[model samples]
Target: MSQSPHHKSFTARLRAHKIFGGIKPAVYKADALRSRVMPAPLPGNLVLPLLQHQGQPAMAVVEVGQAVLKYQVLAMGNGPLSVPVHAPTSGVITAIADSAVPGFGAQVQRCIHLQADGLDTAAELQPCLDYRALSHLQLLALIDAAGICGLGGAGFPTAEKLRVSIEQGVELLIINAAECEPYISADESLIRERADRVVSGAEILQSVCLAKRCVIAIEKDKADAIEALSTALQDSSIELLVLNSKFPTGGERQIIQAVTGFEVPRGLLPVDAGILVQNAGTAYAVHNAIVEGKPCISRITTLTGSPLQTPKNFEALIGTPVSFLFEMCGIDKSQHTGTIMGGSLMGIELDSDEVPLIKTTNCLLAKSTGEFPDPAPEQACIRCGYCADVCPARLLPQQLYAFSRSEDLDQLEEHGLADCIECGACAYVCPSHIPLVQYYRASKQAIAERDRQFQTSKQWQSRFQFHQYRLKKETTKALDKKLPGAEKTTANEPAQPFSRDQARDEIAAAVRRVAARHSNRTAPSSAKDKAKDKDRH
Candidate 1:
């Protein structure tokens, strides 16, 4: 029998598929999941963290004893890179301390404990319904006032992204619906349920960026989502593109390529190619920010895994504890030994369920022993190229593994270690079951630490050099001032044999030449011509 041509490649090996063992899909649910249009009653207590968005954490303006109302700015966003923190509900500020944050690497963050007043009283909001009359800057101020951020994993301030896009001349706004991760159904569910809101948000983004076109790209697997968005935006300029459901297709770079066929170069942003990509959830948030007076106080989270009694999406409050979520779902944490904040592919394991939800907590997975068995003990690498074949970033996993193992920072950098997205795709496919992503992360962290130290050293060196230069200039100036006829000195005289008057003449002449050149370039053409004619006469 003739062998098939496909048998020659990794596709054949992948087809074998013996490793995963046909694991059944698990259903996870959020008990209190609510729609943006619906008025979901606020949680009993809201723990609004100071650092909700990316960039510098917002500075807390309210004291512990102070009372605050809903939509009130409890903390002010710091710098151009951050967004303000708003009270999720009317409450008395209880305390500010290091608190647990879910899906985040850091166990402790600056958290504001709020005891909800339960009245949900309105806070004074600066209204700008007639946004058309406002300038772009005015629109941006409104967005900032609404405390909007990306809402996707990035959590970047929305206004900052818009400002950058406008300044850089963005042509296309790509709305990402490619929720390619295994268990993350937040974006999918949002688009299916709130197509109109998502479309409206995209329009707002379109207006802000002044983009020529808007494209909502969803995965082909999400047929219902594609249909919903397509129907909603059929008459509009927004185009819906169904992309292949590849893992990491939801990544900024990948989606940019999938939609516009433009690859953002390594270490560059999507805006560099005149493209701006925002998450579907982010678009929805933008819509709410513009039309309705709301900040990103809550988001849809998928609470899934076999351990849970019920599995469905929930619109979770930002500061709700993970334990509270599990309790709401009627899941007994005692029954499950392991819990992860994200999907099995890339989620981080939680030390405890006491962690409070943050902006990036997309899904919470509780795994019983039967559902998610612990990985087999890691073994030595046998030089098999399986890891490389599955790497979404197209990096040499084995080589990176080798460099990481040896702590060869130079070699790792040369091998493009920073490009690793830590997606665990390579580790998932490794025949040797090496934790390639973990090793890469360790290496990257070490490299980052070293770079930080280098930067600090460079900063100190720069300061030292600057101080030395200043001292030298001051000393020279003092010597020139003390010397006879020193003010007349110029560059023509040697420092040792300093002829003050002659040096002064040389300096004056050089200054005159520079001033004349500048004046000639900046002066009116007629004035320059007349001066030239007078010189000739």
Candidate 2:
């Protein structure tokens, strides 16, 4: 693909940045981020929540005190858009109520607290040994029924995307392996450990989505992962595309553009442009869901930073309490000043480590003052426009920042505020260290809520308008029937009549006239009473 002039200018600016100044080109390879240790199993007392995925929270099927085996569906998918929650370990549901989750802000969701029996007993698997025989829709339904979703951070229902693509016609499927965030190495570790499973998962996803071709987009940094995936799927129909090692390159739209040279139009989805992308980790989960009847119970997470005595990767069970994982990894909170989930750039800081791990928990970074330095207090924008220069979406971050700061919501929306991916690229490069992405997220949420309210009001107005129109039509028909020689009048009425607005105004005027006449008739009774009082006086 030919580089656009805009892209060329942006690249030149990026090269001048202090952060990229002395970065060795060899460090861009994927092996630099790969964890040296294999992932370890999580601890007991998994706090599995019902609402892990992006859609409607899965409805709880297992109640408190109920025994649930590993891989057993604890919560079932409520609709076509939802995915089910499963037991990470064989245990008794201790509690079924609200629990704290990291990175969720103020939203508390219903959680199933499981006290493990240490048995780790899994339910009987219904393996699809002959998955080749199953039709596309059949395979998709199985994936949905198993409650599988994108293990990638988005957590959108996998089956729903497939169904949508089947209807809309998806031409290409891009498997994202660009773990672009600074320290989140879960996807890289997964690729290193389960390359074949990841590829198999991609094939299953491709079949269900009915895409003509599948492209696995791995970062040039992860050469080992690229080689492993390429070797595993050498004879398969999947193509591995090595992408540039850049922060936020793993974003669905960015990866899609890098691989297919297609820019997904603003406010439109990948499927709208005949593209469906899934994370490499999500692909592995899909593979297990289809072939092994395994639900997404566990995922690999990177436990790294300077605070921990030893930093490594671990296969964490969904709902595993953050406190337990930290303890297991020898992470002493007393020694560390703060903890952040995901990565320092885009991740959220934890108020407390007691929060349970959700499906999207990819990394837990415990940092002291030196490892991850705190930014200076935010100041006024100097109009450097460095943010816009590095923004992958090619949006004006400074403009968005100004609109958001002023709370000019209309102007914000007009500026395509919703299109901001909140990738923290702007904040990452900003000299003033302004939390531009946070403001954008808050603005987007507010705008989305407003839009939802507007849509609801519109629907109500439409319904009311329809009903009023029907009532007026009926009233007119009744009035005509009641009039003298109504049948003759109807027969003589002209085919071409007044416009609806004119007719409505006339009806309103007539109603007001009739009201006036009624008031006039009642006026005499009050006069007679006044005359009687005057005579008595």
Backbone clashes, each candidate: 13, 4
lDDT of 2 by residue, 333-425 (tens): 667888898777778888888888787888888878887677789998999988888787778999999998888889998988877777787
Could you tell me the lDDT of residue 336 within candidate 2? Answer: 88
Give lDDT per model, in order.
0.75, 0.78
Model 1 Cα lDDT, one tens digit per residue, 81-106: 87888787788999988887754445
How much is the lDDT of residue 213 in candidate 2?
77
Model 2 TM-score, 2 decimals = 0.80
What's the lDDT of the predicted structure labeled candidate 2? 0.78
Off by over 4 Å in 2: 1-39, 104-106, 455-537
Model 1 scores a TM of 0.79
